[model samples]
Target: MSSASSSSVSAAAPASDWSAARIAEAAAEIVAGEQLPAIVQAGHPVLRTRAVAFDGQLDAELLDALLTIMRRTMHEAPGVGLAAPQIGLPLRLAVLEDTWAADEEIAHTRSREPLPFVAMVNPAYIPVGDGRAEFFEGCLSVRGYTAVVRRPDRVEARWSAPDGAARAAEFRGWQARIVQHETDHLGGTLYLDKAEARSLCANEEYSARWAQSTPEHAARALGF
Candidate 1:
């Protein structure tokens, strides 16, 4: 598989230069309504740093405020999911929502459905089987591109709700994809790490060239 070229943002700075202060500044811009926080690019130190567990540190007021910000940020970025590290917060937290239901073709291809807004803390997932599904993926943190990533088709996740209640459920298809992707962020992992490098491309190029392709087609055409 050929490795995809890095986006300008991901290559703009060395990994070491992305300090917490920089992340804080970026985050403050969003919280203060100055501007939406720039999504931390893939090579930024924050994206690669392992996130800390929220545990019991977050009180009701803090958690509520954080959730509001995160949901707004996710919607502003127009992404289905957002993790804490993506906005410079190294906490095991993520928000996701997919208001639109998949069309018949897409539903048949990936079994995706609309998802309500969700906030998860300290989320972890386990693969259900050897079954795997591959699809094009993009990230707010990575920016400007997408790549084919093969992931477990189903997963059982354990997480905490805002009220400190334990939650566990099995997710399949695109739902599983969203959970796995967000949880990976907490562990300092990115889909690029597991992507078919040759299949990566700029968003425009992907839409023009491979948007209609399926996992089997991608494997045949891109050698993933």
Candidate 2:
């Protein structure tokens, strides 16, 4: 089968309350068939441009469609999070998977663990606690490169949920980093902007060093 057909089949097969027919219809409207999104490459103007604020109500069909697209795109690309702009949609919204859970088998194996899906709309973050951690970062838009970026080990974020409920929540460790990274994308800032000079690396180099560095040391090395 063609890659596009294969992707369509995969996306269609996810078992969720979200209807397959609805997903297929919405996907057709927002995405171009099964083609991979034209991820805004590093130098693209849109990648650097701050997205316009989303002024409409959150519970609309469009928001639902966007959420689906974000989920599918992130899943297809295997990233922990994605911002609307990365897929050429200009909206102040992003999605992040809780990476901490993904990294630890004990966490993932727990029955009550929250699903990895999270969506933030018009979100803002406040760093909580003075501790910081550094971790290797990669972007779907800037495929094949990785960087070390430092971020607060925890943060307090406020945003409206997809259902229009206001939320204030604390996130720590890798979850904190993922939220901050995806939030920056909504604001049109790539990790490269916040990345420390020495921490930047091609994928292979990053893989080599990521295993050796302490979290704190990695954060500092990445200029976080």
Candidate maximizing TM-score: 1
Residue 152 lDDT in model 1? Answer: 91
The residue ranges of model 1 lying beyond 4 angstroms of the native Cα positions read 1-34
Query: Relative to the true structure, how large is the alpha-carbon lDDT of every model?
Result: 0.73, 0.62
- Model 1: per-residue Cα lDDT over 1-224, one tens digit each: 01111001222222334444544454455566655666688777777767666765455766767778988888877788888888877767888787654557867787687778888988888889899988888888888888888889989988888888998888888888888888887777788887899888788887677766375665678776
List runs of model 2 lying over 4 Å from the truth: 1-36, 57-59, 99-115, 213-224
What is the TM-score of each predicted model, taking all chains together?
Answer: 0.84, 0.73
Alpha-carbon shift of residue 213 in model 2 (angstroms)? 5.6
Candidate 1, residue 136: lDDT: 88
Q: Which candidate is the best by lDDT?
A: 1
Q: How accurate is candidate 1 locally (lDDT)?
A: 0.73
| Steric collisions counted per model | 1, 1
